[model samples]
Target chain A: MIRFEEVNFAYGARSVLRSVSLSVGFHERVAVLGGSGEGKTTILKLILGLIRPDTGSIIIDGDDITRRSESELRETRMKFSIVFQEGALFDSLDVKENVAFCLREYTDMSEDEINARVRHILASVGVEQALELMPEELSGGMHRRVSIARSLALDTPRMFLYDEPTTGLDPVNADNICGLIAELSKNGKGFIMVTHKVSDALKVADRFIFLRNGSLLFDGNRHELLNSDHPDIMIFINEVCIQGPSGA
Target chain B: MDVKRTISDLQDFYSLSLHGLLGIAGRPFYFKDALLQMDYAGAGSVVIVVIVDLFVGMALSLQLAAELSSLGLKMYIGMIVGISVVRELGPVVTALVFTGRVGAGMASELGSMALGHQVDTIRVFGLDPVKKLVTPRIVSSLIMLPALTVIGVAVSLLGGYYIAVFVSHQSGTVYWTSIRNILTVENVLAGASKPFIFAYLISSICCYMGLSTRGGSVGLRQATTRAVVMSIVMIIVADFVLTRMLLYVLGFSV
Candidate 1:
């Protein structure tokens, strides 16, 4: 489980998260929905212990990481993995090396074992053909798939954090990624995704979190979101409707 | 430059450099990465060092012979060139060139990694960026710079030899003997120590700049430029300071 208690964050005077508090159960599938620069990414980073809250505490897997040293945080981070917005693949490494990185670092697996494991993970993610290709050679969707494969390299990580995973891609690729997330969600592990794409979020996550101006405005399932009377929530739904009619 | 910012940067640089040095004692040392960096910093740099130092030695010999022949001291050309190149020019020029080649490359590569989120990815995988990236670079620079300086000194002596024995018509035996006689223990120590210091300064400065990169490509370009400029300036300044301190400590007449 992960818990944020009255967490506040700022970027040198410009507050991003303001007295925000939330929690995620071990097997929960959550989508944090917000506009651009509404501190969505900041929330994901905080969960990963990538950045600390200015005030209050964050507890991950029952351990408070608020003031933990970087070395300590490294141990905590082993419980989770993050896929950045752009896939954030190591440009210098080929897809195989990137996917095999964590396994090689933390596990005593033999070379053949590591290769087999990488191949299995890549096959699971449907990017097995990209094993020898560099990051630049992969398509946008393929890059994100490879990123997901890399994240799944570690057997111990129980939660996955996705930061705008489908932000920049064509409709077909976006749908493919949404489908991938849906497929991964069935594994019974926690997932926390921050994205502006409401339709895609509605497709995969059972719980939705709405952030407006750095504070949670709504937190519930699809029924509550569709039936919400909050003016801002209604405005957001209407705007998405006006932009394009979504099935969700 | 803002004085406060400059001081703050220095403090950060010192802290990071100290952390990098201490990392040598930590667990999970990346020996393979260090060896790869050594190849990049040492073997990749030999040809350039040899060529540059050769020209510099030849130029120094030409000027020194012209001036010394008038004073009937042309045979002393090897001594002057040897002492100057071994104690000062070889290390300084090598460090400056390294700052341009390897140091700038370090900053840009790391800057791109920082921007691309690869550094953060390393952290997420339970790895220390300092240990994984900066330490190997610092270690490689520490080992390679001094080795290159030795090579530079030897090639420089050969350059001086060619000018002294062939161009200036001095006896090859006299020139070689003069170099052998002038390079005392103190002079060798002075020459040997400067490369280590310059290597530390260059690697740390470049690594700090690379990891601190912000914005985007513009920020990366600025960081790379700043790293090269700062390292070059620091090398020259450190060379002067080390020369003066080594002279006094080694009991050489100032």
Candidate 2:
């Protein structure tokens, strides 16, 4: 399980996360929902050991990753994969190379083995046809899928961290991403997504967390989230679901 | 107003610079990246160097020929071209060219990465940005600049020779003999020394400017421009300082 205890992060004098505590059990598909700049990405970065909490601890799978050495952190990182908002694939490398990057860096696997594994992951993400394509050539949705394929190449019991997976996609492509998240969750990967999309969250998130003012305002199952008497939750749902007269 | 804070900032800057240096030690030595950087620095600057060197060499030969002809010593044209090209023009021109091409390119690319959060991505991956990005560039520039300066010296002399022999119609044999006589160990050593120092200055300044960039696209542009200008200025200043020091040590009049 991934756990945060009394986490507090501040940028200069301004506090971002204050005494925030949260946890995700093994095989849990948790959606952290919050509006923009509410420390959603900060939580993910802390989990990834990208940044340290000012005064707290982050423990993952029995290991306190917060203070691990760089090599140790890299070893731990192999257990998880992140799909950044913009995909973050190296522009000079093609889809195949991008997927095989970690493998090439950390493993002594032969070219044939790397190629086979890359092909398998690409096929799994439904981006096998884009193996030869550059990042600039891929659509936004396709780029995200390619990033997923790259993440899956390690094939560990991965924790897939997505930051606004559906931000720039059309509704159809957004639905496709939701479906992909659902499929990954069904496959038993620990999928933690940060999003404001109620429909997407409801479709794939088994557990929901609403963060407000740097603290967890709500943490419950999807059914509980949909059936809650909370006014804030209701407002969030309305904002995501309710369209204008002509459909926004 | 805040002396302690100022001291702390200075301390942090030194620590960061040391961190950057140590970080550079961990990257895989990429020969391909080195070759690409060299090509960008050296091959791309050939045309400009050739054009400028041709005019400079021709003008120097013309002035020297006119002065020496009055004393019936016109054959010393080759000596003049040889000493100037080997000891000063070659290294300085190569550095100026590198400042324009590779220094600006490094600053802009690294600055973009700083702005785009790619450097953060690298850090998260347990990779030091300095190691992965800056080290290979620094090492490559250090190695390649001297090699490029040699090429520059050759080209400049050839341009000078062509102007002296064909354009000016000075005796080819006399010109060649004068060059052979005047070419000394100090001249070659001095010429070779300049580029290594210039490479370090240019690469470090560019990398420093790049990593220090804040804001976004506008900030990156400013860093690139600053890197080029700083590198050029530093190279010129260093040239004067190094020349004086070298001449003093060699018992030569400055």
Candidate 3:
């Protein structure tokens, strides 16, 4: 489980998150909805210990990781994986090497074992054919899938932080990524995804949390989110669902 | 300054530098990368050194020939060429060439990596960016500059010797014998020594400027320019200070 208590974060003189608090339980697929510059990615960064809160503590699996040393944090970071917006795959490395990076760095597996594990994960992500392709040669969808395969290499029982997982994908690819999130959650892995995609959030998220002006405006189950009369949520639903296939 | 803060800063700087150095040291077979860098730095800049050394050597021979002939000391032309090229021109010119050629390229490459968040990604993946990226550059530059200096000395000596013996019609035997007689082991060592320090300064300054880049693409360009200019200035300043200190310590008057 991950929890943020009264977190305050600022950039220079401007406050981004002002005493905001939230908790994510294990195996909970939570969709964080927010407009641009709403500090959603900042929240994920704080939870990942990439940045520390100015005046609060972040607890991950019962440890306050805000004060941990770099080595200690790096060790603890093996418990979670992040899929960045750009996939952040090393362009210099091939697909197999990219997926095998975490395994090679943190595990004592032999090259044969690492290759086998990489093949297995790539197959799980439906990217078995892209074993030797460089990241530049892969499509956007393929890149996202490769990043997912890489993220799942560790198989840790913690969380997945996705930053705009379906941003540049076509509708079909976005839907596939959404389905992947749902399937992963069904198999009991905590997922915290930040997106502007309302339909994807509605389809995959068990719960929805809306972030605005550095604060949480709504936090409830999917049904509650759809049934509620909140004007903002209704506007979001209407714009994403009724306004053609522009969501892609 | 607080002792603790000073100590912490020193530790961080040393740790970063050592990390880079160790990463480079472990990868001893990055010879291809080294040769690529050397070609970019040394081979690409050869034209400029050749041009400048040709004119400088000609002018030097002419001036020394005139001065020595008036004083009945025309036999000292080879000595002058040997001392000048071996002691000063070789290392300084090679360093200047390196500063313009490789220093700017390194700064820009690393700065772009910083801007693209690639450096941060490497750190998050628990790899030291400095070690993986910077140390090899430092090590390669250290080796290349000295080697280039030796080459520069050879070329300049050949240029000056030709100007003195053929153009000025001096005896070839006189030229070779005077060079052999006048140049000492200390002068060669002194010239060779400066390039290592020059290479270190160039690598370190470029790396520092690169790592300090902010903003984005424009910022990276600015950092690259600053790194080249600063590296050239620092090389000259360091050369002066180091030469003076070494000479003083060696009981030389100038």
Q: Pick the candidate with the highest TM-score.
A: 1
Backbone clash pairs for candidate 1 read: none
Interface RMSD, every prediction, one decimal place: 0.8, 2.4, 2.2
TM of chain B vs. native, candidate 3? 0.83
The CAPRI category of model 1 is high
Q: Residue B50 deviation, candidate 2, in Å?
A: 3.5
Ranking by DockQ: 1, 2, 3
Highest lDDT against the true fold, candidate: 1
lDDT of 3 by residue, B1-254 (tens): 68996687557655655666666656324455466666766677677666666666677788888788878887789888888877787788778877887888888877877775566566566555676567768877887778777777777777778888877778889988877875766776777789988988898878777876888888998999988998888888988987887677656676
TM-score of each: 0.95, 0.86, 0.82
Tens digit of lDDT per residue, candidate 1, span A135-195? 9999999999999999999878888899999988998898888888889879898789899
> Clash pairs of candidate 3?
none
Looking at model 3, residue B21 earns an lDDT score of 60
What does candidate 3's lDDT look like per residue over A1-248, in tens digits? Answer: 78888999997678888888888986788899988888888987787677788899899889999888765776556667788888888766799988887786668999999999999999888889999999989998898899888888877637788889999999889888877777777678888999977787877777889877888888998768767687877777676557553323
Error of 1 at B68 (Å): 2.1
| lDDT of each residue in B161-190, candidate 1, tens digit only | 999989999999998898999789999999
lDDT of all the models against the reference? 0.91, 0.79, 0.79
Candidate with best DockQ: 1
